[model samples]
Target: MEDSKKIIIVGAGLCGSLLALRLVQRGFKVELFEKRPDMRRKELDAGRSINLALSSRGLWALDRVGLKDRVLETCIPMKGRLVHPIDGDAFLSPYSGRADDHINSVSRPGLNALLLDVAELNDDIQIRFECSVQKVNLEQARVEGFDHKNNCSFSSQGAIVIGTDGAGSVVRRTLMARTPELLFNYSQDFLRHGYKELSILPDSNGGFKIAKNALHIWPRGHFMIIALPNLDASFTLTMFHPYESEIGFNNLKTKEQLKAFFEKYYADLLPYIPHYQEEYFSNPVGNLGTIKCYPWQAYGKCLIMGDASHAIVPFYGQGMNASFEDVREFDELMDVHGDDWDKLFTSFQDKRHKNTNAIADLAIDNFYEMRDRVDDIDFKEKRKLEMHLEQNYKEYYSKYSMVTFRPELPYEKAMILGRKQDEILLNMVRDKSQVVNVDRVLTKIKELHENMRNEI
Candidate 1:
């Protein structure tokens, strides 16, 4: 590896660290920069996304780095959702018909620290924390920034620059600034709903307060609260609510209002999270938004990936998984277009843009389903029918299964076929009065898939 063949990555988060390791494995030198103090040296935010859902796509990326088994040792397996209704006992809805197909809850800081540790051990990788990137010359792969630690300015030009800097990326901003030449297109849609962090402490025995392996949900019509298990036996609870309504974040400003609202909607969950009132008032509310942009690559010398290019709502739990998949895909492309930075950047953008867009839309659609339809009669029936199909037929996968468990399938294709299958299944369950035939449903789906493939 030489300076002339170096790659500059702006953002030493999960995506950037993973990308640096993969690039170094392929014999390219890397210079990694981050705007914040290194978390391994200092403490991280206490109330931020402490844990994330890790599924097949993210696992595939981790396996490529030979860290999958090590990471899995730290995760808590979540088999399904335990739905708690307003007036009835709780019930479980399996994520998939297959027993082994499930997601894992892993701590965000734990995983990032591992990634940074491995990246630092590589001889060809150099990491610069506490450096803020101010400007980028896209065509020349140059970066100018301030070093917060040393109080100095520096600039460097590498062979290529990749932005894994997240939703408000400075590298992406440079692309926006040269919009006329790049013909860049961008759109951001913010949800009326926002989220605040809450928590459920472990029992006196230092065990879980509820079922340890399931994600629990309390889905009220307009808003909801969900919990994910942590390695410490406690659970991280998140309240997703609107901005200004009766039970919204703004209106429930006092302890009395919050306690009453919980009594009305989330009564069963209140006992487990006795400290909710304190956490709710102290934690900050975070926005839920989607950011989509075009021309991810400008002049083939600079490119944006991960949340920097396609930031999505978190309802689908695919935000981190999707970014991990980006590293996997980009690493594979180096084999096809070796040493041609322009061709490699072009292929990466063309391959990922549509699939990321599909996941973005799917995540948004899931927000409504999680809030309003998970406990509905028809939606329940639809899920039951889907489970039957998956159990009896190995080839069948629900939309959630396609997105979560099938790493070989592109998300755009999964979205298209899954949407069609959902429509047919819902119609059959609603419009018919007889027992559903699993064989007939499978046959119909295969026939329709063949027709769609031929048309494409």
Candidate 2:
């Protein structure tokens, strides 16, 4: 392939920076445009979800760029979710088989900066900050943007324009406007629930108040609190609650109401958050929404990826993972088609649209499972058996293992395969049939496992 093709990438966020690096590596000239200032120089806004859980799908992409070790340097590995029971002792359950079945906890801005730095290192990729994408002109294959300081509009023509822009993507909006009948469906469902971040500052001894190597969840049915570790030995705690509850922060105007609410509902978290009073009042509430769209590409000259294509709730922590996978897939398709823009993009959209929608749906469904059902007696028993199946069957069976630890299987196929296996196990439990032996189940799972491995 020639090294002269020029590409304009909008939004130098995680997905955008990664795609730029990959494209540059393939001998394409790339320019990255970002609306925000140099994130490396600025701190993330206080109330935003400052960090996220990075799993296999995301790590695999970094590995492709030869940056896995460098990225891991800033991460704290969490072995599993530490479930805090309302009336009993907290229990930590591993997501994968071995003690090392873990996910990395790292700051969003930190990861983004690392990716941007790597992108900049490549002479082929030129990054422009404070450049807001205003529109995409598909006819001319160019991107129009506004300079923040000069208030002047600028334009760049490219072989192709990729919108790694976020949910409110100008590129996507422009693409849809140009092709209204492209089988695109767009919707955003705002959850009645909202989230706010509170910090568990490091103790005097410079250690975490709770386990640093675990994701702590204070699941209280209608509302829950989760804390993820930071490299600074502090924990970023998020409170997810209904927008309007009897004793929520919604209607509480006085400190008395605030104290009463915290003492009653979030008592488990109060001790760890010593400055809760101040944080509770100051932190801005973040609205939760699920964004869905179809046919993520328009003409050969333009396409959409990441949250711009399918933004889901953060419960499954798969948003970043899915977006990273998109970058990898797009890069591979471009590689296979030898820069035949139309052929490569058509193939990418056909394969990626279904995969993105499936994961987006799963992310939405996971919210209820985390908030309302993780602690249910029957659900817990089933999950325990599911974990056992992952170990016993080893080759054919897995629950959390496939979702978090493996990126080889497509998200939709993994979901379908898991449900079928769970249904078989659930039937056995319902009938209390010991004759429905574990060995028999393992035998059945082995065949399915073989199929799954091959399909991926």
Candidate 3:
């Protein structure tokens, strides 16, 4: 009976589906429940999925699941950020000095659907679409919810329950309900800024309106708009702005006002988006928030993973990548502890919580950097110095490179080293009176990493 017990996974989205496939591959039965209609058959969520930037960490996870090549076949690679400033000529900010170290732009719904499809191929995994799991009895490993179609409740018990239900997670809610007993620590920080999805249609010949290989950024001081390429030749644009400022989402209600605002800030962007007014009025503004919680595993029988355990803002483009990496990390723990859910869950969370928290903080830091710091004189010099170091020195990886390209390094360590490197580089770049030495800068970075202890 113990061996026959199934593993229940909540929310059959990206993380849940990939996780289910991995579980089944290890000869475990998985019941994956999703609340929404299967997107493979239905239309995607209207106007809000900013195209996901799939990088090394995410690719490593997919590779383990045997989907890396399949996924990559459909993804368009973005080499760097092309920053569009309001005052002058736009310039490209390379994500890395190396061309091979690029990020892929993948459709969120498309990727999720692919995961669901692959997950369903295995008989050991049973994915029920339109069924929502609202509560989990942590002690007993039981889940209770309904098939939203008929409004009928159902319950099941598993060897363990995994919550990958994302930001507003019901599994996480259950853990919160047991705060007194679990002493569960939790916090949510919502950004003052929010984002509304818009678009840049392809040219008449179905070609990309802008450079397809670059992630386009119209960076304003307080807010910014970002665009990523899609396979359809069109670009998925997200307008991230504050809710209460002069260029706030709440203030622009009419066409005239919206037109005036765009003309002032995004004049160059107008040619690509003739339907801006229509999309602006139609799409909803999504909130940007980070959710962090402690003791991701509950009672050795239930655990939370991905966005359910640690939700972060989309600024750093690591939300999905981090979630994918969660599966790889969990799988590694399973390799060591085989079939012992208790040890696996505890070990998994213990190693992961700090890393997740680091990325959350890093995402917030990137928000400000992208919004206000990208075009600064010192910042440009810093980037130029970093590019030179990266090209010549194989040992050197800028902060973004360390986090995005290095799958072997943990997020916590990457953040610690990256921040220190940034501070040093910034100081050096700011004081242009002295000549900069790439070898010396790399030596300092190496020393910092070597001297670092495991603070996480």
TM-scores, in order shown? 0.97, 0.93, 0.96
300, model 2: CA deviation in Å?
Answer: 0.1
lDDT value, candidate 3, whole model: 0.90
In model 2, the clashing pairs are none
Q: What is candidate 2's lDDT per residue for 20-139, written digit by digit as tens?
A: 888888778987889988888766585344889999999998888888889888899998888887777788767765556789898998888888887788788878888898978875
State the C-alpha lDDT per candidate: 0.90, 0.80, 0.90
TM-score of 2: 0.93
Ranking by TM-score: 1, 3, 2
> Which 10 residues in a row give candidate 1 its minimum summed lDDT?
447-456
Q: For model 3, how does the per-residue alpha-carbon lDDT over 210-253 read when each residue is reduced to its tens digit?
A: 99999999999999999999999999999999999777999998
Evaluated at residue 374, the lDDT of candidate 3 is 92
| Candidates sorted by lDDT, best first | 1, 3, 2
Candidate 1 lDDT by residue in tens digits, 1-456:
238679999999889999998888888899999999999898868635588899999999999989999999999999999898787788899999998989999998989999999888989998999999999988789999999999999888899999999999999999999999899999999999999888888899999989999988899988999999998888888889999889888899889888898888888887888888888888989999999999899877999999999999999999999999999999889889987988998888899999999999999999999889889988999899888888988778899999999989999988998899899888877776877776777788778777787532
**Stretches of candidate 1 exceeding 4 Å from the true structure:** 47-49, 432-440, 453-456
